[model samples]
Target: MLRPDDRGVLYGEGVFETVWIRDGVARLRDAHLARMARSAALLEITLPDPAPLVDEAEARWRADGEGALRLVCTAGPAGGEPVLYATVTPVPEAVIAQRADGVRVVTAEAGVSRERPGWSLTTAKTLSYAANLAARRSAGDRDMLWVSTEGYALESPTAGLVWLSDGVLHGVAGDGVLPSVTVAHLLSEAGGVHGEATVADLDRSDGIWLVSALRGLAEVIELDGRGRARSPWTGRLSRIVSRRPG
Candidate 1:
């Protein structure tokens, strides 16, 4: 286990990946590691060898039966005593069920400014997730939208914001702080993924859903506390991918 005194705990330094593990296998292991490596580089943190981490995950998966995996990499202890820690947690049935029904998401966006230097932390999965937690809490009335100050639809605390326009899958495009592996795979497999959409496009639509690795995809029955059932496409998409548990 990673210590509370580790650099991640102390300075909230280092990147992490919440990779999903199910059926005795880990999904998108390569993409997650690649993102981690990219994030670590942006932070100028030295990443430990990936082989050991891979071995650890495989061993733990075989030992613990299997579920979802949380991979965390920090700067380690003050003097470099702590190393990266990996843990496995069983995937909650509720998560899958919610995905089945589709999760509602409040529109949220990340603000990148000259002072904030978006490149510094926008892409890295740092432990300083207080803002995200706050975004979740700030999601008052359950349907609140947390869009960018500029009104661009960024993403949700736990899910990527995916919308459909003219039968096309349009998602937000940027550094991909969106945690878009599932969507990425969806677009790659299904084809025709358009990024760089505006919140106006989403609002003009019939509905929207919050997306994530765990929840997969959940529909937004409402937006900004408004009661709206959403388009039939939500159920259709959910069902279309039901047979394949990607």
Candidate 2:
């Protein structure tokens, strides 16, 4: 948790990512670290060497069981210094199972600042996660958290852009929000490209997914607070990830 005195806590300011590491190997560490670095640069904070952090995470995965990895960087409690860290943690079995089965989702307008200037760090995945966390709290077990602003579906609380349209891959604006490294990786793996879409477009697509590194990928089995009937594509995506070279 973010400490009270932490700048990222007092004022939302930082960037972080949950990486997908399996069998002690991170699937897309480079992409994630590069994104983190870009975010830190945008925020004007000095970044610690991520090589050491990745080494540590890899060590832990070897010592522990296979699972998810969460890397968080804070601006420090004083709010004006470089403080970065990362951790390797297990993806909840239940969460993974849910991903395998698929999840329900609700889209709500994001409270992003006009310029996103609430001392808030929209680009940085900082500790000031109150609003997103609250949205998650209000979400049901099957509910995949979503944030939209001005009628545009931005992203999920902890996941990346979810776009669903026949064979055309889609994602939100790259510069509008933080770039989703995991989403990018999946798009590459699927031999697909990122396209754009509306919530309605998603609803009328061939598949819907909440792509993240830790969970690899998740399909939205339910939508608009309704339990959507299961589809075959969900399992197919899972199999694809499973067969992917680690």
Query: Global lDDT of each model?
Result: 0.65, 0.68
Off by over 4 Å in 1: 1-5, 55-66, 78-82, 108-119, 140-145, 175-179, 239-246
Compared with the true structure, what per-residue lDDT tens digits does model 2 show for residues 165-212?
666566665545667776776666666676666677777777778876
**TM per candidate:** 0.82, 0.83
- Which lDDT tens digits does candidate 1 get at residues 153-174? 7666666667777777666665
How many backbone clashes are present in model 2? 5
User: Top model by lDDT, which number?
Assistant: 2
